[model samples]
Every structure is written in C-alpha cells, then in structure tokens.
Target: MKQAFDHLKAKGKPDCTTLTDHLDHVVAATVKAATAFGMNVDVARQGAILHDIGKAHPVFQHRLKDSYKHSPTDEPMRHELASLLFLPVFDKSLWPVMVEMVVAHHKSTRNDTKRKGIIDLDERFGPRAFALHSAEWGSWSPTALAILSAYGIQARPISLTEAREAYDYAFDYCKNTPDGYSEWKGLLMAGDHFASALVHRTYNQTRRLFNVPLLTYYNRQHPLYPLSYIAADSERPHTLVTACTGAGKTDYLLRRCRGRVFYTLPFQASINSMYERLKHDMGKDNPDLDIRVLHAASRLTVEKNKYEEKTIQGHMGSAVKVLTPHQLASVVFGTRGYEATLMDLRGCDVILDEIHTYTNVTRSIVLKIVEMLKLIGCRIHIGTATMSSVLTNRIRALLGPDTVHEVALTDEQLDQFDRHGVHKISSYDDAQERIAQAVADGQKVLVVANRVETAQQRFQALQIAHPNVPMLLLHSRFKRGERGRLEQQLTGKRLDATGRPIYEFNTGQGACIVVSTQVVEVSLDISFDLMITDTAPLDALIQRFGRVNRKRTPETIGKVKPVFVIAPPETEGEAKPYELAVLEASFNALPDGDVLRERNVQALIDQVFPDVDNILIDKDAIYVNGRWRIEKLVHKPKSVLFDALDIDSMVCVTEADQQAYEQAGYEERMAYEIPVRYHAIAHNGLARSEGGNKPFIVPDKAYDPVLGLQMSLALPAFYNSFF
Candidate 1:
C-alpha cells in the first residue's frame, strides 16, 4: 500500500503533489472562488486544506481507482469512511467536514443510481474498511496526526453522522427543484471543493498569508476606500442604482466588498462575455493573480503547455471569478449539498445584473434570494438600465438604504443620444419591409428578434421575398460549433480550406442579411449598417440599437439608421388591463410622439410597472401602525402578464414539420421540461401521439447522429397563426 502511495506521489497525483505545491494551488483557488461569494478567507482556507487529508490512505487511493470502473452502487470506497481514523490522530471535531469533502467530492447527493456489485464487497468492507489494513500500513491517520501535533494545531472532529445528515438534507432539496436549482448546487459544491483545496495548499506552501483587500478604482486611480465608505454609511440599507447600460457597477461593488464579490448576469452568454472582459482587465492589473470563469460551458484559454488540465486544476485557487446568475441562484434554491455554496455567499458582495429581465415566479424567487443574502449579511448591488420603481423599492426594503447606492443618467444625458436622429418604428410589417428592401438593394442588413423562432422566421421570409439576397440566422439554441461558423461568416472572416465561407450566405459577401435573437444584443463587437427588431421593453431595445451604426462615423446621421419595432398584439377584454397600463403610461409620458426624445421613458416605466415594494404592501401596511388605508387598484396574479402575453402557446411554425420537430426533442421540452410561459407548435402533436390518435410511425432511416434533422430558424409564415 505504501509503495502504491509512493508510486502515485512520484507520478504527481493531485492528492499527493508535494504537499506544499498542492496546498498553494488549493489555497489560491479557494480564496478566489470564495471571494466571489463573499466568504471569510481564513475560515475558507482552513476548510480547503483539511478537507481531503483522509485521501492519504492507501485504501482510498485503491477505491478511487476501482470506483472509476464499476457503478457507484457497487460499494465504492469512500474517503469519508477513512475520516473516523483521523479522530484519534487529529482533532475529532474537524473530521466531520473532512469526511464530508471525501463523500461529496465525486458525485452530488442527488445521484440515486445504484451499482450491481458483489454482496461480499459490501458486507465485509462496510464503512470501516479504511482502518482494516491500517495496522499493516503503519496507520495513515497517526502520520497526519503527528504532523499536525508538531505544528501545535488545536483542532476538533465533528461526528460523521452529523456531516452525513447535512449532506443528505442539501442533496434532497436540489433534486426536487428545477434546473435553475442545479446552478446553486454547483456553486455550493464548487465552494466546498475550493475551500478544501485552499487549506491544503496554504498549509503545504508555508507562504505568508494576507487578508483580501477591498480596493476601489476610479478613472484608473485607487483612491477613497470604498469599503470604509460602506462601513460608515448610515443611510438607507439599499440604494437604487439607475446607471447607464455600460456603467461600471462591478467596479463599484468590488471596491466596497472586503471579503469576496459575486457578480451575476441574467444569461450564460452574457456571463461568458463578462468573464472574458473581467479576466482581461484583472490580468492587466495583477498578472500573478488567479482568475477563473465558472459555468457549465466556460472555457479558459491560457498560455500553458497542458492548458486544459491546468485551467481546471488552477480554478482550485483563483483570486478573481466571473459566473452566471444561474450558478448563484442554484446555490440558494437547490435541494442537495447547497449549504457549502450558500456558506460562500454568507460574507460576500453580490451584484445582480439585468434585474428587470426577471419575470413572474422568477421575481418571487429573486425576492427570496435578496432576503437570504441579507440574513447572511451580504451586501448587494442591483444594476439595470430600465429598472421599475417597484424593483428599486423592494430591493431597498430588503437591503436597506444605507447599504445601497444609486447612479443614474439624467434626462439630459439620455437626450444627447436621442439627438443622433435614431428613429424607433413600431410596426412589424413596416420594419420587415424596410429591412427586406435594404437587402434587395445590395446592402448588408441586421435584424434582431426577441425569440429564436421569431428570428428564424424573419430571416427565411427575407430570403424568400428576395431570392437574390443572402440570409443567415444565429441564436443561442444552435450548437456552439455551428454558431461559431455562422458568426465568422457574418464577420467576413476566414473562409474554409475549400475556399467556401463556413456558411453559404457569405459568397465572398456581395450583400447579406443576418437575423438573430437576443444573442446579438450585447458583447459581440461586430456592427451592422441597419437593424430591425421585435418590440422588447425599452432597455433591451436600446441594447439592440447599439448593434447597429455602432461606429460614430462622419456619415452616422440618417446613417444612424432606423430601429423598427414589431408591434405587440392589441389587447382586448379581460386581458387588456396590464397591456393598457403599459400603453397608457407610454402615451402619457411621451404624448408628442417622441419615443426616443428624452428620459420620459423612465417615468413611463415607473408609472406602468408596480414597484417591488408594492407587491405585498397592502398586507404589510395592515400590520403596521394600526391604520388600514385601502388602496383601490384591481389586483392580478403576476402570472397573468405571461399568460396574457401568450408567449408559451404561440407556435410560429406549422404542423408540416412535426416529424422533424419531434426528432429534435422539441415536443418533450415544451410539454414536460421547460417551465417558461411560452408555447410550442409541437405540443399538439405530442398530445395527440400520447392519446393514440396518430397514424403509423414512420422511421427516419436518414437520421444522422451528428447532425440530426436540423430545425429551420426561419419557419414559414403559415406557422404564424397566433393572431
């Protein structure tokens, strides 16, 4: 057993890579990941170091190797099983979490699949297998004990049962929840993994340690301690910030946070972009600092020989991190093993981006998030361009005015941009016709839509209307490789080796029409001559506009181009209330037909949208000061907005593509999976099939495993039967 350990150590196994080298990497990663969640460095580092000491056992080494092959049900050797042996050698209290790290490291608690294993392996080995051969191998725990004792470290062990219970409770909670819960669970697990790694690295390195500093940057100067200002402020607990889209909200919050900072974006795509930009900025300032981007789809490009493994291992000690809101949301709402990640959020600064994008149940969920963070002493910074008074007030009530800060661009500031003569069109047909004509006239055109189906349909229509014109479509739903290829073609980049642009639309680029969904709203550096989009709420529309005529050239006047809105359905009867409120506010605020004229849009937003504070204000007011002032507005469920919009049931395509759609798992996802309020065209077919109402099944022999049957982003207009 000792020889195996020696051999593995010689091979530089991560668990045995010269204690110092391993400890340093772990410490750096823990501190960095923890900082993002606002955790205490000293505690986080200690947890990181001691989390995996039991891995020193030969039995654990053998088990890890063996378990890699068989199903988990096959009585796999667990590191936590060896933690009991450490009680006598080291402090018993510390053993609880050490055991936890071992048990929870490989698979999450939600996994229920059992392995088909030999019964003898389970009966004879049981959980005490770690100490069975300990005596023959000189007892691995004693060696760990002697080392700690020599250093005069006073530690205590926590019962294995208690640790197991905690792990079980967290696991159950995450499994029963939504996919969003997975993000929170992942964050918690990452924190635990990072913490364990950090403690080990720090102890092994023997390097000087320092508390993370909270520094502020303003116009490139480090001045006016932001943390100190935060500590001194006695104003409202929360401040409403109405900054412009590009304002440095991240920089402001990071400066104020002492322990760690969590910056969250609404979408994974946006998070990826922010991660790259933040890493680049931090790398320029602190070359030696470890920076990481954490998301299921995150990719880090570095200048190392073995970049892939190094990037993965390096995250065990990053100093800065960029992650998606889905990651953070999962930690708080997830069922299983989320406590560790929640622990990271306990002492951090949180930045919630694009808060206005949250809708209905998500709004309720986010409220719980803010409340949870506050309970754990988190300082939150909410940043958005089109924030409603409701959101601002709700956040303020939870976080308090003293902890919040507001930085908004005034009406005058908004006016400067409006003067550029950018027209905001409200008719879909007018917008579509204008863009189609532009493409036909041998000009490049960019059209943005709110949804994937919408974008695809518009692009196809443009192509059919003008057969001589070239058209391309892009969206988040496309496979990554396919999207990359299309993006390159649109940008006029390198053609393939066969002298063909990755896409047929770019035939050496005479003129092309590129239609996209919200994916192109921000972060892609490319610009277009013109853009027409479906009418999204204001902030998103403004973002879409930024994609067009981006460069402020001398020809940038009418060259500024027109932005046409695909008008929403006209509301009627009972469904009219919410839509009427929005329209009334828009008209009242901008009565003179000047939609892009001033900051009046913000006022319109406030009047139409209910303040977050007003969500349950009447109920709360009844409990305060013994005064009941009846507020006489008709109340409706938040879900009504979504239902009224009928986003879920609106199938943009026809039944002719049923077979192609079913193969794509569109029916399953729309029916039983995704909880969003939108409708899919495949739902009816799936229902009919379940009821045995369909004709004979026709097997598709030409189905390619790699490509499958591709769904056209450009659906036929015959599919648009929503009206």
Candidate 2:
C-alpha cells in the first residue's frame, strides 16, 4: 500500500516528492509572485497547477525510481512538453500564456541544446513521442486529474489522442519565439525555483517578496555632506550624482529610489560591504525588508539559510540588493535565466556606484546595460568619483539628457572633499621615511600594488621593515571566510544608536600598515593617514586616493593628508592589466607636492580617457542596438560571457581540503574555493575534484592560512619560502 501511494511522485533525485505536494507549493508561490509583479495571476496559478501533471506518466515514474536506467527509447520524454498534454483541462483563454509559461521553464523552447526542446522533440519523434508518454495514460490520468480536481480544476479523463492533439497545438504555437524575451517564462521560472527550494515554506517567503524598503535612514542631513542637503526628489525618472568620495553619494542615491532597488557596484568586495551597511541601517525600522548581497561567494557573507541562498542568486523580490553589474550582463547576452533577471530588474531603481571600475570591454557592456535598463522602465542612478566626457555623453544620451537629474558638487563644495595631497615617489622604497614617520606618529598607512605578487612581496618587505607595527595584507585572492575576517579587522567599529562610531579599528591605540592590490581602490571603508601606491589608470588611482584621509566629519572635512604615487613601470609587460600609456598618463597627470583639487578631476579624467567610448564591444557582445544580435530563443554559451566578464574562470583548492570540499554542504563548500584563471593551473597536473564548483586540487604548499595562494610555490620549489 505504501509503495503504491508513492506512484504520483514528481521528483526522484535526492528523494521522491509527491506530485500534488509540489503542485500546491508552486501554485501558492506563482499566485503570490504574479500578483506582486502585476502579471496575470490566474495564468500563473493554472500553469503551475498543471505544469507537472505529466510526471504522473508511468515512463517518468519508472525513470524516477531507476534513474532512467533502461529507457523504452533513446531520448527520455521531456516533462516540459509532456505537461502540455493536460492543457486542454484548464481555461482556454489562458492556454496560450500557459504554454509559454510551461514550455521552457528548464530549457529554451527552440534551439535548445542537443535538440531537446518541445519543437525539437516534435521533429525528432515525428508525432510518436505522445504515444511513448501514454504507455499507462489510462491508469495515471485519473490520479493526475483527481489531484487537479482537488484544486477546484474540473476535468474529464484526458485520452492519448486528446493528449497528442494538445501536444500538436502546443508544438505549433511554440514553433517560433517572439522577437523579444518572454516575461511569462521568467515568472514561471522564478516561481518554480522558489517552490522547489522552499517546498511548503514558499508562501511564507512569498509574503516577504517585493516589499519596498523604507529609506528614511538616509535623510539624516549634515552640513559637511553637501549631497545630503540637495533635494533627492525630482520630477525626473532617473538620476546621476557625480561627486568625490565622502560626499554622501550613497545616501542621495538611495533617497532617489521610488521602488525596490538593485544596487550595482563594480566589485564583489564592495558589494559585500554595502550589503552589510544597508542591512544594518535599514533593518531596525523595516524588519521585513529583503536585503541581499549577490556574487559568486555572496552566500558565504550572510548567515547560512536555504531560502537566502536560492533567493539571492539574481532572483526576484529582494527589497534591496547589492550586486556586481556582471550579474545583470546576461540580459544583454540573452543567457540562461536572462528573462527572469530582467523581470526582477524591470521598473526598479538601479544604482551604478562607480563608473570607471570596469575595463574597456565591461565598460562597453555597461553601456549596453544602461540601454537595456532604459528600455525596460528601470530608474537608473549613477554615482561616480571620476568619469570622462565621452562616457558621460554616452550615458546621458541613453538616459535622455532632459529627463535625468544630474547633481555634482559645486567648485567650492568640491574643495571641501580635497583631503589628499598627491606626492610623486621614485619607488615604494622611497616612502620608507614617510611610512616610518607616520608609524612613529601613530598614523595608519596604506600601500597598493597592481599585481598580487607585488602586493605579497611588498607586504613581506614592509613586515620586515616595520617589525613592531601591526600590519595586514588584503587582496582578492583570499578565501571568502578569511576575507570577511580581514575586512572586519580593517574597519570593525562599535557604534551608538545615533550611528556615530564609538571606536573603530583600534582607535587611539596605534598605527597599522595595510598592503593591498588595486582591490583597495573601491572596497574598504577605513581611511589611512598616508598612502603609497603604484601608478594605475588615472580614474582607478583617484579611487585609491579616496582611502587616504577619508574620515570626513564637520571638523575633518578639509583636513589634508599625504599620498605617494610610485612612477609607472618600464614596459607593457610590467603593466599586466592596464595599458602602459594610461599608467604613465595617470602618473604624469597628478599634481605632485600639492592638493589634488577635486574641481580639476574631470579634466584629468578626460585627459586619460579621451576616447573611452571608442572601444569595440560588438565582437563579444550578443545585444547590439535595441535588438538582440543572437537567435530569438538561443543564447551564447557561458564561456563567451565569462570571457567577456574578464574574471578568473577556474577555482582551485589545496590538496589537503579536497575530501572536505567534496563532502561539504553548499554553503560550507564555498569557503574553500580560490578563484584562478584556467591557464594558470592547466599544466599543474593537479587532480580535479568532482564537487561544488569543480575546483582543482593544488598542493598544500601553494596556499597558506595567512599569506594566500602562492603560484610560484604551487610546484615543489626548493628555494621557495612557502614550501
């Protein structure tokens, strides 16, 4: 009896779950999600209710138990196509929409990989696939219909011929996709994802979806922060705040939003910091606000919760989200789940924090993103420290010049944010006297390098030079857990309810030295009394200068400190990422031994990036102009986007943690990953683990608990100190 009762199971992998239970959970989710998104709720609900009835067929049932051990034919029946067989039982008016919602939840309806789509199946099977799906239709149709009737859906028994006829109708309708995306597909995908992840708890989370957060916390104005005094409300639909750092750009951007927000930053580390800050500030008043951070390792930043893990992966209903713009780039490429992401971002407020953090390719993609956001009715707010005229004109043109509310600090006000004097140094070693003097004076110091190897070397030499002073090294190479701990140590502060810091980072105790890479350009919240940095792009260097003398208050608004810029390296090889011309231009453009005036920054930026809009984006991009450059329902492979992303493609873990990595849970496993470029480890001959993220197992000597991954020490090197 017990074995027979399990005949209507919908899912078999991991464990068997009943069809009716899954249907009910998804129905509740779709109804709530559809209502919140202003979509057709009945269409969503009916589609959800009937989408999985095909699982009741005996072939799927047999495969559900045996994992498709020996199939009746070569290709297993597509559940998405089989679900259409029961469409005749639902409201006829909703059938077309229902077909859109169900035909491609897991795969594209046309141009699916390996010819697995509904239309592909029709062509492959030549109308015999429906008969294959109806081996036990008489026995299973009653059970499936009874489950539907329980949801108040009246239906008679669906015959094999009737099911085949339904398949024919759905196949003909799905033969061609629209010129644009299908938001109905997005709704179904999101709903199905939530229900599948949360099960019976889906409704509880659904009630928390799309709750617009209260941003009154940002309204606290101070005279020192001039952007706070400027009125954020305007008749314009979009906004842009061009101001120096410490000018209250974040608060002004938040106040401009009229709906749920998608806060996009250029880096994941900065995204994590903003997520924590906004969560702390807003959680006190609006307890139900769904604030989430998004990135590859974002889950490790927050508390371990199943719903949070699935809900924050570029999903809908996050009240306030902090993420990298790369997360939204798929919309332009029409990658998998692009429609769902577009649906979530539709009619929302998007804040692009820093304009120049991306390289030439990503900058071009961001230009396309601005275009997509404009088309889909999203209110955009851009915050930048330094931006060129060409890029500004491009953005202004895309956003409509007359409709955008552009606010920048006046010349007098920009003078207030001038807190760092640019000092040219021959090399980092030349800053020894200044660093020693600052350490003696109990002042914090920062050192920046362009490459991770240089940063590690600088840290070692500095640690030996300043043997007694507290020192730390921070870069993008650290593991997620270690990085979080380091960020806390860098700026950990105890604050009163009024938000004034009582104490922070060993305040009033002593000085510390932080050696880092260009990552420090936009990630940290702490300020140093002095800075020593290698020359980078002028805009990037300006962002690095923001870390020094950054503690601004009514009294400390105009207080100036010193920042040393090392001369650019000799050759293009030395400047691995940035162009040598740009680096030299950035170095030469700085006003040595003088205050870096904020009013002259735009001219400086334009000097460095005279033709930032001249970069080519068409070769790698899938969306050009207002229309997609790819097939209607087809998408570019992830490799293409990953290449365009310009991020490290592969991850590796130490040999010591391979077993632990393979056995770890989803949340715990993320901590072990160390993102690396594929070519970097391709010749290492390391055993790759078949686990989460599929990381290659490097030798234990390559990684250290304190120093991070050392590629030179990856192999057995007798001279390497890490060994």
What tens-digit string does per-residue lDDT give for candidate 2 at 161-184? 788888888777776555677778
lDDT of 2 at 675: 75
lDDT of 1 by residue, 1-723 (tens): 223223322113344453334434554665655565554555555544554455566655554452345554544544433433443333445433333333344443322223111122234554333334233344455444443443344544434444344334323332333322222223335644543444444443222122243243322432221222223233433435564433344554455455555676665455555665665566555544554566533442222253332234323333455665545453333323444455556656676766666444455556656776776676776767677776677777766666666666556555444422344455656666676677666666777776655665666677677767666787654433344445556555436778764534433445677787776665444556666665554545556666665544334422345555555445533212124344334433333223354366567567656554324322312112222221111112223333322334222211433444345432222221111112333432322222212311112221112222224322232232432
Query: TM-score, each model?
Result: 0.61, 0.93
Model 1: which ten-residue window has the lowest total lDDT? 628-637
Misplaced by over 4 Å in model 2 are 1-7, 13-15, 66-74, 122-125, 128-132, 304-313, 493-508, 613-615, 619-623, 628-635, 716-723
Best by TM-score: 2
What local lDDT score does residue 558 receive in model 1, on the 0 to 100 scale?
A: 26
